[model samples]
Target: MNSQSPQTVLSGLRPTGRVHLGNYFGAVRNWVRLQEKYRCLYFVADWHALTSDYADPSKIRQATFDAVADWIAAGLDPKRSTIFLQSEVKEHAELHLLLSMITPIPWLERVPSFKDQQQELKDRDLNTFGFLGYPLLQTADVIIYRAHFVPVGEDQASHLELSREIVRRFNNFYGNVFPEPQPLFTETPKVPGLDGRKMSKSYGNTIPLTASADEIRALVMTMFTDPNRIRRQDPGNPDICNLFQFHKLFSDDATIARVDRECRTAQIGCVDDKKLLAEIMVENLRQIRARREEIDRDPSIVWDALREGNRIARQHASETLELVRKAMKIDFPELR
Candidate 1:
C-alpha cells in the first residue's frame, strides 16, 4: 500500500451475511472512529468470499448489499472514507496476478488460516487455484489503497507480516511503489452468543443487527445465565453470566453496578435481568433499524456511492499499476 500521510488505513469484510452485534462492536465501530483520524479505504470483499464457499454463491449479491447497508447505517461516512467493492476495480485483479508471480508457494502454503480453513471445511473440495491465491488478492487490496495501517485482531498479525515480506520482495525487484503495511491492533471484547458460545452465524448463535424487536426479545429470553443460580432465590454470579457481559456494554454503568449488587444478593431474578437487557438492546436497535430503512428506500444511494468509489479506486490503482508496469518493463512505448 502507498501511504501519503503515513496514516492511511485499509481493511475489509467479506460479504457473508447479515452482520451481528458482535460484528458492530468488534470491527465496524473501530472503522467508524478511525475514519475521523486516518485516510480510510473500506471495501466489500466479494472476491475473497469465493475462496472457501464458491459453491452456492448466489447469496453473495444480497449479502454484499446487506453488509454495505449496515456499514453506512453504522456511521461509516462515505465523504471521509473510500468505500468500494473489490470486483468493481479490475486493477486489483491485475495487481493480484502480478504479486502472485513474486509471492512464493511456501509463503501462501504457510498462511495459517488457509490450512486451518481447508481442514475445517474438509467436506468441500479445496483443491483450486483461487483458494490458494486469495491471500495474494488480499495483499493487492491493501496495497492498492496505499494503506499504511491495517486494523486487525491478534490472530491476523501473521497475514500482515506475510504482506510486508511480499512488499519487500516486490520492491527489491521493481521500483519502490508500495509500502509495507503494519498492523493496528484492536482489543475486541469477548461477545458471547445466546448459546453461551462465541457469536457466529455458523453456530446459529448470532443476534442479527437487523433482527426485529420481538426476535431480539425472544433470543434474549433464551440467553444463558449463571448455571449455579438455578433457583430464583439462589444467589447468582454475574461474573459468570453472558447477559451480565451484555449489560456492561448496553446498559448504564450505574444500572450495571446495581445489577451486580442485586444479583449477588438474590434481589434481582434472572428473568427480570434478561428482560432489562432485552429492553436496552431493543432501544439501541431502533435507531439502526430506522437508518437502514431510510437507506433501503433509496437503493440508488448505495449504488451511486459505490460507483463514485469505484472511480476513485480505479484512478488510484491505475497510477500504481502504471508505475509497476514501467518498473517491470511491461508498458510499451506506443502504449505509453
Candidate 2:
C-alpha cells in the first residue's frame, strides 16, 4: 500500500459507544466525505479515553469496537482510509514523551480545555500528569503522521492551534520534520435533543444513528417542539422549535418550506410534524442501520479491517519515529 498520502488528513475519535444523530451529522458524515478527497487516517483514540475515564477503564475496549462499527456503518471505508487503534501504534508514546521534555509547563496549562475539562469533570481526580500532558500527546498524534490537515469544527480550530505551536517549537529546536497541520474546517449542524437541549448521550436525549425504525419513532414522538404553541390552532415558531431543526436535516426542501410556512399559520400541529420527522429519520437511517446490524452480526469484519489499518499505520509511525529519534539525537545504534 502507498504509505504516502500527499496532504494527508489525520483525525480520531475517543470511544463513546454508538454515535447519536448529533455525532453523525456534525462530524462522522464529514469524515466519510473526506475519505473521497484526501488520504485520511482515522483512528480510535483509546489512550485519550484514559485521560478522563481512567477510574473504571473497563468500558474502553467495548466502546472502542462500538465506535468503530458505527464509523464503518456511517461510511468510513477501511480501504479508503487508514483506520486503526491509537494504542496499537506504540511510537505515539515515545514521541509524546520526547515532546513533553521540551514543552513548558505553562504551555499545557494555558490550553483552554485543560481547566475547562477539570471543572466539567470536577468529580474526577484529574491532578495526574496524564491529564495535564494530554494536549502534548495530541500534538504527537498528529505530528507522528506529519498529517497536513485535521478536520475540525469551527469552535475546535483553537484547540488545533496549540498543536501547531508545539510543532513549530519542535522544529525550531530539532530542525523542521513535521508540517503545521491546518484545520479542515467543516459545517456542523446544531442538532437538538428530546428536551430542547443540545443532543448528547450524557443528557440521555440522543437518537442513535443505528436506532431501529420503531425506536426512532418512539424517540422522535417525544421530541420537544415550540413550547408556547399550546393549542393546535395556536401559531408555532419554527425557529424556536427543536423538532423543526431536525426537519431541516431529514426532511425534503419542499416539506421544510411548507412546515415553516404552515407552522406559523397554525395549520400544522406539533404531533403531525413529529410523525413526519420520525418516518423521514427512519428512512434516512435505513441504510446505515442495516449496515450496522450486518457489522454487529460479524464483528470480525470490523476487527479485520482495523488490523490491516494497524499494519499500515505502524509502518508510517516507525519511519516517523526514526526521524524523530535522529532529530532528537537519541538514535544510538551502538546501544541497540
Candidate 3:
C-alpha cells in the first residue's frame, strides 16, 4: 500500500466453471493487455463467490484451478501480474468489515445491480446478508490496496462510482488511507452464444476456452443467425447476424469483408459461414489450448504462481491494514 502508484490496476473474476469465450472477451483478454503497462493485481474471487453459491460449494476448488489454468492459457504471465486467491488474504475480509461499519445501509441498498440481480435470480433465495454486502466487499477489494484503476467496459464504468463513493466516505472518516479507484474503460465485445443469447454458463451457452476443435465446430454449427434468412437462397442481413460479428473478431480483414459481402448477396449459405467461422475460431484458439495443456501437465505451476503471489499480496495487505487500523485508532499495540 505504501508503494501505491497511479498506475496500479486491480480487478478480479469469480471462480466459475471453465473459462469461456464470453469471459475471455469480457475481462481476461483485456487483463492480459493491462499487465504489460501497469502493476496489476488479478485474483480468483473465491470469497466473493460465496455470495451466491454458499448452498453448494462442491465445485469451487476445481473451479479455482480451472480459472487459474485458463487465465494462464489466455496469456496472464504470473511473472508480470500478481495472481492470488482472495480467500488466502485475510486483510480483504478485515477491510470489508471495517468499511461496512461506516458505509451507510442506504448506500448499499441503492446499488442498481443489487435489486436487479435479486429480481432476476428469484429462484435462489438471495435475502442473506452477504448478497447485499458483496458490493462493499468489492469496494474493499479495490481500495484496500489503494488501487488507482479498475479495468471495466465502458457501459459498466458507472458501477465503479459506487466504489468511489465508498472510498470518499471512508477517507473522510478515516483519513486518506485509500485512493478512489477509477474505471479504465476497455474494449469489451458482446459475445453471443449459439442460441443468440449473451454467452453465459448459466444459459448452458458458453464455449469454454479449453473446448476442443470438434466441440467448437459442433457449437458453431448450432449458432443462431438472422431468423429472417429462412432459406439458403435468402439474402441475409449480415448487420443483424451474430455469426457475422464472430467473423469480425476471429476472421482476417479479407475474410470478414468476404463474409459480409457473400452473406448479403446470398453467395455464402449459413452452413458455409458457420464452417468458416468454426475453422477460424479453432485456429485462433489453438495456441491457448496448447498452453493450457502444458500448464495443466504440471499442476504445480498454477498453484505455485498463486503461492508466490499470495505471499507478496499478504505482505502488502498487512501493511495496508496497519495504516487503516492506525487511522481509526484500532491498532492495539499492547496486543502486539
Candidate 4:
C-alpha cells in the first residue's frame, strides 16, 4: 500500500508488565501481519494503564519501554508501522475531554468492563471520575487517529461499540469530522498459562516472551496436564491437556499427531512430552530472543523509534483537533 491511501489500523496495549506467550499469539502476531497490508499505529497505552494503576505510577515509564521492546521483538517493524506512547501526544487528552462532554455517564456505566473490573479489583477505589471515564479516553485513542479499523478480539467488541456510538453522537452535534471505526475481528487462539488458566500477568502464571531456554523448559514443566493420567502406563487424554493446546500452536502436525497417539496409548510420558514442547518453543522464539538482546544492549533503539512515531502521531492528531475545533465552531481566529 502507498503512503497516501493505505487503510489505517490502530491498536494499543496497556503497559502493565513484560509481554507473554498469550500476548504474542493473541495480538502482536496479527499486528505484524496487518502492517504489511495497512498503515498501522501501535502505541503503549501508558495513560490507560494509569486508569487502573494510578496508585503506583512509578512503573509506567519502564513498562512502556519493555512493552515496546516486546512488540519489536515479536516482529512489529517501526519502519513499517508507527510505534508510539499515548501520553506523549497531548491531543489524546484534549480529544478525550471533548468527547467526554458529549458522552453520557449512563453510556459509560453500561460498559461490561466497568462493573466487571470494579468487582474484580475490589482493593482499588474505582469510584473516581478517571476510572469511570476511561472508555471515553479509549474512544479518543481510536477516533483521534481517524482509524479505519481497530483490531480486536471477540471480548473487546463491546468496547469498540462504545467508540462507534461516540463517533455517531459527536457527528450528530458537530459536523461529520470523524469516521466510525469498524472492528477487525481477530481469531486469536486460547493460550493457557502454566496453571491451566487463561494466561495473564495478574494471575502470575505467565511465561514471558523474553524467557531464556532454561526458563522456558522450567516453566513448561510446570504446565498442568490431564489429571487422570496418574501413572506412566495409564492412558492420557490429549484433548484435555493444556500442553496439547500449546502444541497446536508451536508443534508441527506430525509431532502433534504422534504426541496425541502416544499419550493416549501410554507410549510417552508427560515429562518427555513437556520436554519436547519446551525445545520446540525455545527454537520457535530463537530469532525473537536474539532481537530482544540487541534492543537490550542499546535501550535507545526503542526510545528513538517512539520519539519519531510520536512526532508523526502528533501531526495527525493536531490536524484532527483542528477539524474538530472548526466543526464545533470553537476555532476563533483571535486565539491563534
Look at candidate 2 and give me any clashing residue pairs. Answer: none
TM-score for candidate 2: 0.96
Deviation from native of the Cα of residue 134 in model 1, angstroms: 1.9
The TM-score values for the models, in the order shown, are 0.94, 0.96, 0.97, 0.97
The weakest ten consecutive residues by lDDT in model 1 span 1-10
Runs of candidate 2 with Cα error greater than 4 angstroms are 1-5
Runs in model 4 lying further than 4 Å from the true structure: 1-4
Candidate 3 residue-wise lDDT, 109-181, digit = tens: 8887788778867899899999999899999888877788999888787778899998888889878888888
Provide the clashing-pair count of each candidate structure.
Answer: 3, 0, 0, 0
For model 2, the run of ten residues with the poorest summed lDDT: 1-10
* Total residue pair clashes for candidate 1: 3
Local distance difference test values of all predictions, in order: 0.88, 0.91, 0.90, 0.92
Q: Write the per-residue lDDT of candidate 2 for residues 63-137, one digit (tens) a residue.
A: 989999999999999999999999999999999999998899999999988988888789999999999998999
Per-residue lDDT of 317 in model 3: 89
Indicate whether candidate 1 or candidate 2 has the larger TM-score: 2
